[model samples]
Target: MERTLVLCKPDAVQRGLVGQILTRFEQKGLKLVGMKLRQFPKELLEQHYSDHKERPFFPSLVGFMGSGPVVAMALEGIDAIAVVRGLMGKTNAREAAPGTIRGDLGMSFSNNLVHGSDSAESAAKELALFFPGADELVDWTPCTLEWSYSVGEELKG
Candidate 1:
């Protein structure tokens, strides 16, 4: 199983959409290995969004993210990073597909409701930023794994 980080952004939390966002992943057969609700510190936000520091939306982006509690989740499944991204749809809510989380619940570009790591490298870095301790993540097999993947498939972490 591959693991990836997913965040229910402040807007999602504020709008009470965290449950629905999480359910979408769960129902997709992804296993939740770790999760927390937190009001992140500005320093952490800065580090997390460091790549966007040169972008125009950097300040407000960090501000909005730190404004309230956000749900950080570590999910595991086959190609979990890509899977989560597909569930989240495009970053700009207005352009997201109708069946996606953003398309269904969001309207603004800046206030898009969720975030998911886009690649293996990003997943590692973002997961570390959100879940630093080795003990923070749990390892377990979901009973539905067999049903989710083929009998001949190889499962890995």
Candidate 2:
């Protein structure tokens, strides 16, 4: 199965929508392999968001991320990265579609309720950042996945 990292941002935790947000991924048949609630340290946040360091909005982004506790998760499923992004909708709540997580519950661009890995490479980086222990994840097959994959098809790492 493809694995992706998903983050229920500070706002979501403060607003008590973590359960609802996670429910969408579970309902979509994504397996939750690892999860935790964490208060991000500035160093970790800087490392995690280093790519945006040169951007004008980088400070605000880091400030918001470190402001409260966030729920980080590792989800596994077919095309998990893409699937999670689809569920999250666009970054701007106003531009997100009606049925997506952001569209339905998000208040603004900066306060968008969730974050999902944009690619396999990003998934690895983010997952490592959130779950530093190599053995933190429990790998197991989800019973229902037998019906989702075709015979002889192997899941991607």
Candidate 3:
């Protein structure tokens, strides 16, 4: 199984969309192994967005992220990284597909409602940033797992 980190940004939390956002993942069959809501401190944001530190938008990005609380989650499933990203839609809300979360609710690129790790490597790093000691994440097998993912050549029940 793959694991990914998902962040319902401050915009989503402030707008009361945390449940809606989480519901999309749950309905898509991803397992929520860990979750929490917390304010993003500048130091944490620096590590979380280290790749973009030199970019011009880094300051604004950090400031905005630290402005409010965010819902951080660790999701596990087959292709969880890509699946979560797809559910979040394009980074630019205006360009997101109609059925996606950003397309349906986000109004701006900077204030995009959600953030999903872009790749497995990044997922591990991001998961560590938001959820230290990831080993503690739950390993419960969802009763509906059989319906959500294939097991070898067949579905498991």
For each candidate in turn, the TM-score is 0.96, 0.93, 0.94
Best by TM-score: 1
Q: Kindly list the per-residue Cα lDDT of model 2 for residues 35-150, writing each as its tens digit.
A: 99999898898888899999999999999999999999999987899999999999999899998999999869999989899999999999999998979888987787766666
Q: For candidate 2, what is the total of clashing residue pairs?
A: 0
Clashing pairs in 2: none
lDDT of 3 by residue, 16-117 (tens): 999999999999999999998999789999889889999999999999999999999999988899899999999999999998999999879899999899
| Regions more than 4 Å wrong, model 1 | none
Task: Write candidate 1's Cα lDDT for 31-119 as tens digits.
Answer: 99999999989999999999999999899999999999999999998889989999999989999999999999999898999999989
C-alpha RMSD between model 1 and the true structure: 1.4
Better of 1 and 3 by TM-score: 1
When summed lDDT is taken over every stretch of 10 residues in candidate 2, the lowest stretch is: 148-157
- TM-score of candidate 2 to 2 decimals: 0.93
- 154 Cα displacement, candidate 3 (Å): 5.9
